[model samples]
Target: MYVSLVCRQWYAVTRAVLVLTRPVVWLETTPSSQLLPQLENTRTLIIKRPQSMKHTTYVTWRDGEIQCWTETLNRLRELSIERKIKINKIEIKRHIRVDTWLIPLLTYTSLSLTNLELKDMVHREIPFGQMMKLCPHLVVVHLHYRDTGYIDSICRHANKPEYEPAELPDRLRLQSLKLDNVAIGRTILMRILRLSPDMEELHLKRVAKPRSFANEWLNTDDRAEFSQHILEQISSICPNLKSAHFSYYICDLRSLASEFHLAIDRNLFPEVSYWSFKWCDLSADTFQALKTTPNILTTLEIIDDASAEDHCQQHLHEFLCGAPNLLHLKVPKTLFSITWFDLEGIVSTVGHRHGSTDSTTTVSHRKIWACRNLQTLHIGFGCEGEIQESAENTRLIFGYLSKVCPRLQDLTIRYSLLSLELNRGFCLLTRLHELRRLVILTQCNNDKAWNVDWISKLITPSLGARMKHWAAEYSTMNLGIARARHPFTSTVKNPLLHHLLEPSIQSTVNGGDRRGDEYGHAANAERRKEGQLSQLVPDYFINGVDMRNLGQLEDIVELLQDRISKDWQCWPSMGFFELICLESDPNGIEPFKDTIRICRPDVEVK
Candidate 1:
């Protein structure tokens, strides 16, 4: 029998003890009653006092100041090498204020603190410059505070009369900084940039919003000016930065575009490679700026909640056309039109002239002009119109790509267009013989409407003998039309026998056929059933049946067999079949299985 660790608190305590023991050190005005015995052999100790000590909660910083806390903390410090002192955060609940306290526990332990976390320090009046001068050995700093009033506090602290160097152990050693929802002014942001030039990663989330207007700077245009200011600050501060994520309550694409444009113009980043834009308004101009960004952007993602179809299409086209180096692109399911984008100058001189890199590689009377670096294409959509249009455009785009993007490997087509006429259009892929895998997603109803015979005849042979993998997916609704109700069913019936019978049937009928059959004879008093205008002749259908002249299934099968003999190579994998969600009944399952298995034993029935 095995027992689960169901009690979370107990499990946490057990796990913490098993990891190792470190000294409990607290810096405060008074010593604690219960000292941590584990600290007796500790190698280092730190104590930071809290603002108040009125609360007696167990986890509160004030609880560490009791006499037992002092004893246990001193004991632990004597036993281990690393000491950590955490200050409790103050919370006001129901108009009641809770006080948190920290007490000093000094020891001669010599362990160097490799990691340090400071919380709830009253920095309202302390200059940021002074605060920096205090934490010298800090490798990572996380500053969390209310956004409404914090920036002013930091600025006020920075302007204090006495100048103090930031106590950060080594300014160059700090690798990461996270400022969470803290109000930050432009001056403070600049100071941080100046202070930590060597920092590898910086995250400023929910930072202070920029002023609405600035009088002195040029480019006072509402959208462009504010965006330029933000971009300039980023480029100036984090030039070597690799990745930066900025998400706000709301952000306009123009602002982001201005920033990216500034980064390109200033050559701000040589190493920055990944960028993410989320919930930002993207326009044509914004996309234009992305194309000019100087750094090599390997991955670009845009996530938007906008529902306007026209805006979505415009932005998508601009991004595809301008961002020549982008390799992976992801847009909303509503943005499928973006995928249908054709490199403007693939086949014509106009396309090549506009193509990036001026690579003159030409083949098959076509040239690839756009997205030469694009290798992976991921798209999500609910309909097929976008895909059809994209396929048509891609036929032209791939002509020039042979030499330019020789490494192009994968193509994923996902949509629900299952109409016979449209599925037939898939034969267009014969042009990309270089493709290794072909994924056909039949999740949509349209994909299920495929006539297995049509796909087998059209797709298999056109794809050169080099093509190896073949996949056919069945949709939930097979969308199969019955033979009798088929539009051409009447035409396939016996022509001469039907003409001979029509005259005889009309002789007894008084009125035209009530069933609306195109070639049916008129109804008569003998055929009518009381109030019914017309009725089928039960005796006439049994004795007057037209089977003598009607074509038989075997005859049709024989003809199909002849066509198959000549076209077998067209569907080399015809034997393999898969049926999905087919009513889950033996009746629904057996017929299709028996039919397909007769022609191809490898047929799969599901």
Candidate 2:
């Protein structure tokens, strides 16, 4: 108002600034007299009702505010009406009646509106197709039904013979559609798809059965057949579809295998590069089908079912040989059992014979390295003590990963238990010049606590020189016998050895060593207090050692100062040393920060 009073030019600039800064506005109640005119030029409007607001109050506010926004709606490009409160029986029924103001507002702003989202709508009937028809320029539509009951009602109305077909323009501009927790039947889903012929992405999460067949159990065969039919329809209608996610139910594992075979046979989703499927048993036939379009799939996730058989391992090997372009592979841990021979085979297949002098081998004799281009590998193993039996195999697998996957950057290993012996193989990871991140997660006993020595072996000075991030976490399932000393405390504390090892421990220091005061009197009390503190503090590693121990702080500071001053050129400016000393060791970072400033004045620490 002050700017408008100043001059016409000033008023014009102020209006432009307001339009750019306040393009979207969220209102929980009717706009105040002061704010109404200020929101006249808003390009996007988001109406949100607080859960605490009374139903009657919401209705009054919504009606009055929407009526006042008639002129503003004409210029609106995006509109989202979301009800966060739970609706009572009365309110649900009341919401079923179409808000008289909504249709008219949509009709007037049809050409301008491009994005719309309706979430947790309590209405008994919402003409979704009709709304899309009215807004011909809509590019994205997200509909989250309140419950299966609402979806059933919509399906019933849509099925009516006298129901008028949605008025659609010559070409639909919609590119993305997301349906959450909807229970529409096949025909209704087909009709929805028919509206958006140029859709690029579609997401259907937790989709239930139609209202009429909510309790009906379509057998595995029937469900798979129906799914194949739906996918076929989608492929035929949306040629430009790039990504799709949908949950599946398979009574028989073979049904899932059959579905994949049929999809590949028909070349469904030929251009799709990303796919996520729920837990299922993949058969050899499915792997064979995957070979049909080897290079097309870039990201694939197949969650494992506990009851599923592990017969797909061989099939997976064959699939990898055929699809050498896969960049991301995630599967159950049991499917992968790396051995020395596997490493040799991979090296020979990829023609990466570094030290070998065997030049007589022909190209036909070499196998195709299936995952030559793989960058991210996630292997999830079951918690049945299997990891213990194959501990050495796990080590060999890690040691050879860089050799097999020269381009590997990210690796995640999930298992039930991990042994310390695996550390030897972990040291080989330093060979991966391009590797940046390594994560190991295990749900097992912490009986064998990992210390700085173990961490140092894996993240050796050479590897640490190039590695950006690495973490190892263990979650204990049951309580084990307690040890006398804190799990990480070393009996012989040599400053030189401490400086070299940089052990990762998990206990805080108690002022001084009271171990000799009494056998089990005050010492027990102190140990219990330290144990409680350990439980409160999360596990963090400094140079692979637990960050709780302050015993090696002096040694660490001296070592860092010396390294930064002498070998500063060779040291990683953003390496693990900085990560652990300055970043992970929050309570002890101050000392290292001071040391860096005093010693390496030229190096900047962030």
Candidate 3:
């Protein structure tokens, strides 16, 4: 008998004891008859279609599997009622069509569900309106509909006729509605929205105007009218909406604004903040729309889209300087913000006034960010010249963030791996006392002079008191800073370098033979030969970081490595440490991990 349970809140289990208090339960397959009664405490039920079977076999038994799944859930629902325990959330994940198991499950357990998420559902006639009708108490609904890519519907025999809707709700108790990939038809979407008067969030991603009935598609003329109506009347329909995200539509926001001919006073989002620009490309119209956002707006996210130019994306520095009340600003890999943040790399102290380093000499007064309340940020810093300057600039970046955003708890930095001299000025981060999670993602750099092995000088300090392993599991710090160096042309004398050496070279490393050195010169020549290397796995310069040179990786690895030394304890809350490197160079990642693993043998290097 196989049993699995998943929960958001984690608990510790020893060899002698097991706890069944998990709130989130996943019914990945139809459970045995004995399983239902034990799952009465479940608060969130994630129903997912088992994906082990091939298309042919799945097509054959799809209906039967769904039926059994629904039957099991029905029994679970009965058990919940008997125990007076309600399942609050139901997330139907992967390629399962909602129509197959949705109505059947809800028919028995409608009152139990408060939150519903139908993700990656098949594009077919879905009884979404009926679902709202059944689960009138549902507060949050997330729906994503896409044509099933894995299964060719044309080749398979038609299952029964498409599902017909039986009922519709009058007034829904909804607070949030998220639609992805035009999940529902125009007729049904309107019906659901009209009912959800008190909706607080409407997140629309690549939504389309769907046809009402039959195997029909979109009507362009009808779509035009509906699009305009949706743009204009959405605020009126959901008057209580506080947040909205409209993203990745084929149609332009500028065109929509022009076609509607909206007045200056008729703000599209008067009461809400539109966050779609975070993931989607920002245009002139979208950039201009930010001007109308009220000072009360706290969260804003905009990602770098290569398709859009610099002017269209606007400046991140400008936004930060302006939005003083902003609690969160997330801009991922955006070149729009990489101007100058004046943090001086003080190689040595010149003078100290009142035992404090002079900020006037160190920090630039030219530009300053006013977003003092910022709690989370996803930003990148870049420079035009050599990447080493970026490494020097890292201290300044961390110093800037620590000063301006004192409340920052989560930060994701994007930059070149060569630029992340992880050791140098890492002490600046210890000032950010609230910083719970720090993620560093390396932006790709094709520069040939990349040397990650020798960035920081050996000023090593462990950033923790001895932290417990279970505590590390609860929180994590991730740094992904591995890029493949151009296969080295230079040869080294270290015996540890044998891994990257030829067998003939390896044999002669111990003896005073010239063969190893001669072979090393030849291997270096072949490594650089044009069209000579097939990069399924690149032969990286593995032993460039020899044991003698291990000090180069230094305290940067120690602070980031989680296991603390005896003396160090300032950054006491340090937890899980994750280091992700290059996929092409399997050898590139190992050298760094091998060094760290020697220190803490139990830590998994993956």
Best by TM-score: 3
lDDT string, candidate 1, 490-573, tens digits: 233456444543422312132222332344434445346464543543211211221110111222222233334454333333
Cand. 3 Cα-lDDT: 0.48
lDDT of each: 0.39, 0.46, 0.48
Give the top-scoring candidate (lDDT): 3
lDDT of 1: 0.39
Give the TM-score comparing model 1 with the true structure, all chains together: 0.38
* Model 2 spans > 4 angstroms off: 1-127, 130-156, 162-171, 178-181, 202-231, 244-247, 250-256, 275-281, 303-307, 330-369, 383-397, 409-413, 418-441, 444-606
State candidate 2's TM-score: 0.47
TM-score of each: 0.38, 0.47, 0.59
Which scores higher on TM-score, 1 or 2?
2
lDDT ranking from best to worst?
3, 2, 1
Ranking by TM-score: 3, 2, 1
Q: Is candidate 1 or candidate 2 better by lDDT?
A: 2
Runs of candidate 1 exceeding 4 Å displacement = 1-137, 140-172, 178-180, 211-237, 245-256, 278-282, 292-294, 301-313, 317-606
